[model samples]
Target: MTSKVDRPPTYEDALQHPKYEPNQLHPGSVESQPPSYSPGSGMYSSSPPSYWAQAGMWSVPDLPPSGMPTAVPTLSGGLPATNPGEMEGSFSSQWETTSVRHSFIRKVYLILAAQLTVTFSVVAVFTFVDPVKMFVIKYPGIYWASLVVYFMVYCILLCCKEPRRRFPWNLVLLGVFTVALSYMSGTISSYYETKAVLLAMGITAVVCVTVTVFCFQTKVDFTSCGGFLCIASILLVIIGAVTAIVLSFHYVPWLHMVYAAIGAIIYTLFLVYNTQLLIGNRELAISPEDYIYGALSLYIDIVHIFLFVLQISGSATE
Candidate 1:
């Protein structure tokens, strides 16, 4: 006995059958066609072809004369429909997330500004005020002592538990740290003439702003090279230490200038790297919750850049 295989109906085959019901195309299909009705039946009494046509299975311009179904039914509810509050809720959530990230960035920058203000204010006092100048000059040991103290407090804050690392406490520790750092900066600034110090400050400001804007607008992401940047920074620090010791012993006239110029370049790269960290989104992003840490990292980068620029310009004048 020979058996015939049933083949699936094509679009042309569906077209040839005018009285075709959708169930006829499927095996064990349960759906049935609507009952016979008079012309008085409302639009709601539409058969499958009329229903699919109105539901936009195929465009009116492209549909055949029979208004044949063009798409397979996939939606459980048939026609696509929007839920009552779904769009509004989705927009609200997106807006809230965007606002939160912006707010976090703003808070971090404001804190950084306040910290800069404190450092510069202290620098001004030590540079201009005779009593403060005389005291720092008379007792040079305070510079190293303040350096040790600042790092001790910095280490404590870094090691603190989550509960202790929140707002006011973190801010307080940061303020103390800024004060300590400024004292060291002020003592260092006292060695240079007033005009040299001001010039260095101007140069530092220009370099910092230029690098910051570049990081913000550039398409080339520096965050990816974070490990390379970190290794470069350590190597620069070692070179700086060796250079400082050598320069202190003998006058290799051009050595200080070369070291200062290289140091400035290294810290400029550091500024870019840390700025990318602050504007967090990349894989190396610092958590938004670590606003204090972000600010602190940026503060150090800016201060180091200032120190290098001061050394370069200050040495030139001398």
Candidate 2:
């Protein structure tokens, strides 16, 4: 114990000491060794190579190159990239086209209404003018001529590419011709009874309006009735012609009245059927010519109803 504090340890004794042993040092301890410096290298040597630079590849630029603008890829041969604004504009154009189509349909209906008004006014004038003494003709030649002209005009309208353009003029002319012809026909007999004619007209008007309204309101398809009604109509016409031919040998008032009544019923059905077809059948996609055809059908119904009522009433009086 007196000898331990006497002197310092030797180099070999210091190396063998517990403080200088490797097992006693910390796990991550590094030796204090200075790196050797090259003579030519400065304080700031060359920077480490980047990953892409080391691989000899060009790195993408932040922005397009100065003189070389970025090119947008093309689609089909001449088609450009789809822009949202252009797509919206195209949709707007389609909507506008549909609006125009609907507008055209409205105009067509307006024109039809105007034409009907003109026709009715002409008929009214003829009915009220009191031309029984002034415009008498024996053979009803004017009526036949008017019918021929009307049929010709209808054919032209049917065949023409732009029928609407011709419709107004044709309708006006037809109205005038019908009025003139009606006046001529009514004047043929001095025994023209205005009250009876008016009654017939009123009945026809009531029936036509009622049936048309009902058909429109119901919107029921009556196309199925076409075949049956057509066959019946043809039969009625044949019977009427044959009866007229046989009237020389026999006068049958009851038979005539019966025929008239039957004809009236048939015509009533025709009116309802045609109107229902007009209102309900999308397949009917009617044109202006089809409107005229419908008008003609209704007119025929009115005429037949008038004739039947007149005959029935006259026979009853007799």
Candidate 3:
């Protein structure tokens, strides 16, 4: 009989015959465990790596050693793993915020344009229509009545947030306010000659456009001037009252002209201030949620500017 020779198991045999858990006491398992770097200090372990099984032993896929760090998990190209979704979500959130602000700006301006269109239309009818102009002039009480209505609605919209933000109610209130203000504005415009009114309108348009463009581009933040602007407004009102009282006793043409010029300049500054408030990312900005208030503020600024310009132009022409 020829002597038989034993050979190492093939990869297939290693797979088909994995070591049993109970066979842990076997010398192959004991020897397969890592060795200490030094017999004394177990700081480092040495062994044929766990993936290298002895000739007779078989095993399953190797796991990272309990204490040692294994090959760092990576993407297919060996690049470090990262979360695309998290990065994508961050960008999307920023984009959504920006889009919302832009939409809010558009909504406010659209509402403002509609208001100006309605107001100027009424002014045109009152100025051009002889019968309507004569009738409105005959009944100056109509202007007073509109003033009363405008004052009441303005108070409600400004003093109460709920009325300003409420859906159909807000729109209804705003419409009423717009009509009342339109009548008052028309009455004021009627007091001036047609040429004076037209000239004032042209100048007012140019000034408003220029101020709006400046507010958008200039680094000088007008929003921060709210305190100063408010003070200036109160002082203007006081000076105006004084001027009116003085004129009541004795009309001074130069004083009146000076007052009108001051009013125009002050309200033009107000236009710049209010326009800055409309823009977002400022130290002081109107909230996106209160687009109605934004439009109301801008509309008031424009109307006041127009009236003051009309006063100055009328005085100049006279």
Candidate 4:
């Protein structure tokens, strides 16, 4: 052994090495081809191309050929791909929701128009007819009968299933009955008292419109006050009943007038609170039936406020 050192290959010698240009050396020689290399393995000894390098060619791995099985793209672990149909379906669902909301709003406005027409017509007829004297003198029974009928209708609405189905026709009938009875009561009390009723109506209209506009514009939530207001209403009703009974024994007209003024103020507060709920709260998403209920609540508030204001103003005129 002479212990001679082995020399390093020159660049030209390295270029001609068997490992260099393996594909070219094995061109058209299938038997001399290099073994297949896995990604990330050191066997290839070269960096992979940038993903953007193959701009037009198929980038997804293991995708089937176009003519064979349909190719589906997925994330790692193979979840199904998002398709155009799914996107379209989502959009359609959103549109349907919006349409339903618009339809609900339209129905509410239609019903509100009908109610206002009925109410205003009744009030106008009563103003002209002036039947209170005849009702009071000849048909004293009418007052009690009207009260009974109103109570029955209230009960029916509270007890019935699908109360909305009966609402339209029942409201029409009630409007007619109420207008007749109210006309009789107002006229018999005094024809001059009609001016008081008109004044009350004007005040109520102004207050309702103003508060409703404020509620709609501000969009402030007032549902939290609902429970307190309801409790206050019950207490007011009880107090009113007791006071009426006591006043009837004493025949104190002035005390009755004072109560009327107080009642009007309470009812106006109710209108403000209820309007806030309708325009401000998410509970407004309730069905048309609920909208009717809300309208009825506000209607009661307005009507009571008007009656009390009329009674107080009439007493002042007397």
Candidate 5:
């Protein structure tokens, strides 16, 4: 039996004009098409078209639709895209803020220095001057009066921002508060031996210096410790009340000493916290406008440290 071969068709085996363009040549056909021939020798070429000016071809950028900023990473190997004019203004604003903070800190410290000077001066005179010492020792009522004045002024400064920020009046109230605190400190110092008082002063100075330095250098964020410190302050007050009540019946030397040491540590932390608040650049910072309040906070911290240190020393000596 003979079999037919399944061979593929080749170009040579096909007839010419096999595209079947029947409608293209028909005049009335709606699907008319173009002819690749020239009627009167209008020339045609296979070259690509060209334009006078063309946009650049770039890949899709890894950026938002708003276009990429001129800014570049500081450590990266790219030139900065910031405008020169903008850079100067940005730097100026930052410098201005920094300068304001520095001046604010300087003013607060000056006020604090003056306040501490008045305080220690009063303590010295009260301790050394026999007549003044005897007078303060005789009239404990003055100490109570100082307490009242200090509290009233403290409340005014704390609650009334206007008064704290006021010009001459702010200074007046601050001086009054400082003097009242000085008297209270002086009276307390008068009750202790001179050597004990001096030792306490020295210890307090060292602690304040050390705490302030630590606050400056350490990365610890004490501003968030506000709530904790507030609770601690309340607890310390409660402890003070209990100590007063307990000592009314029995004088426990060790109890008072322990309380004094604890008070010292707490207030030392307060000094550190407040110092960081004043220094700025923290999570919580005191406004530069509140110089009076800043001074008062720092002064209070140092005074409490002195008071607790004095208590510890006086108890030891006695």
Candidate 6:
């Protein structure tokens, strides 16, 4: 009798045959293949086909273990493996903050430039033009009246409904304030000789530009001395009042020069302080929302600086 040889079970035969489970023991299979299914097999022993069974046992080839990393669970919206939004959110927040800060600074400087231009133009017109000069000189009280109007308009803008304070209203209030300030500045400039006014303006420009450049370049923060500046400003105001009273009694030339010198120094310091406030990245950073306030602060500083320079130059000529 001829012996019948059983070829190693093919994968197709393994799939079709009920006795060829991957986990079961089979006598003719390779060591990696599980035994054939039998009556004694446990009901829970079913699993995926073994490598040796999937390939015919003798035909199974050697392969190196896979080097690729397993897939990591992703976030919703197709974001990366980590919480994902945290990094993007942080970057966007920083970009927005930087953009707002720069915009605020630009708006403040532009408004200040407009205010200065208006002041200079009004002063020039009133000083040089006969009709304007005559009108301003005839009604000196116009300056004081404009000041009152300015205060009222400013207060209304500050205290009124949000809608009233927006758009054309905010712009109108600012324009009114600027016009009032220009009138007052023009009236004051008329008191000085034309040459003295021009010289004072040039000097003021040089000093203001120099200090502004210094503030931008230097690491030294002038805002740190806020308390000192406040106290000094108060003392200067008292000194100015006293000086005014002394001048009313009798004009002391040396005292006038001293007063002008002191005023210039104080206002220069104020310029430094306010520029620091505008540009500094501190805890008390000027809010982008407060562009009007920022412009107001800088405008006051420059105007005072110009006034003191005029006083000094006018007194020098005398």
**Which candidate comes out best when scored by TM-score?**
5
| Local accuracy of candidate 5 as per-residue lDDT tens digits, 81-163 | 67889999999999999999999999999999999999999999999999999999999999999999999999999999999
Q: lDDT of each prediction vs. the true structure?
A: 0.76, 0.56, 0.80, 0.59, 0.84, 0.75
For model 1, how does the per-residue alpha-carbon lDDT over 1-318 read when each residue is reduced to its tens digit?
A: 423344334444444565433333335646444322223332122244454434434223344635555667667586576675987898999888778777878988998899899888888888888889889999989998999989987887667746235868887788889989999999988887788789888998998889888877887788888788889879888988999899789977588888888888988888888888877655577677888888888898888888888887888898
What is the per-residue lDDT of model 6 for residues 1-318, given as tens digits with 9 covering 90 to 100? 423344445566665678655554557756544443322432223443354355533221254224425566655568545545887998899998888888878988998899899989998997788788888888888989988987787676556655233777666777888898788788888888888889888998999899989988988877878888889889888999999999999999788878878888888898888877787475355657667767777777777778888887888887
Worst 10 residues of 1 by lDDT: 37-46
In model 5, the clashing pairs are 70-81
| lDDT tens per residue, model 3, 1-318 | 423334333434433554311123445454333222322432232233343334332223344434445676655697556579987998999999889988999999999999999999998888888888888888999999999999999999999999889898999999999999999999888877888889988998999899988888988877888888889899899999999999999988788878888888888888888888888767888888899999999899889888888887888898
| TM-score of each model, in listed order | 0.73, 0.53, 0.76, 0.65, 0.77, 0.71
What is the TM-score (0 to 1) of candidate 1? Answer: 0.73
Ranking by TM-score: 5, 3, 1, 6, 4, 2
lDDT of 4 by residue, 126-179 (tens): 565656344454665765676677566656544553653476765664455445
Better by lDDT, candidate 3 or 2? 3
Ranking by lDDT: 5, 3, 1, 6, 4, 2
Model 6, CA-based lDDT: 0.75
Query: In candidate 6, where is summed lDDT lowest over 10 consecutive residues?
Result: 36-45
* Candidate 4 residue 221 C-alpha distance from true site, Å: 1.5
- Residue 298 of model 6 has an lDDT of 76
Residue 42, candidate 2: how far off, in angstroms?
Answer: 59
Tell me which of candidates 3 and 5 scores higher on lDDT: 5
Among residues 3 or more apart in sequence or in different chains, the pairs in candidate 4 whose N, CA or C atoms overlap within 3 Å are 132-184
lDDT of 2 at 209: 81
Model 3 spans > 4 angstroms off? 1-46, 49-84
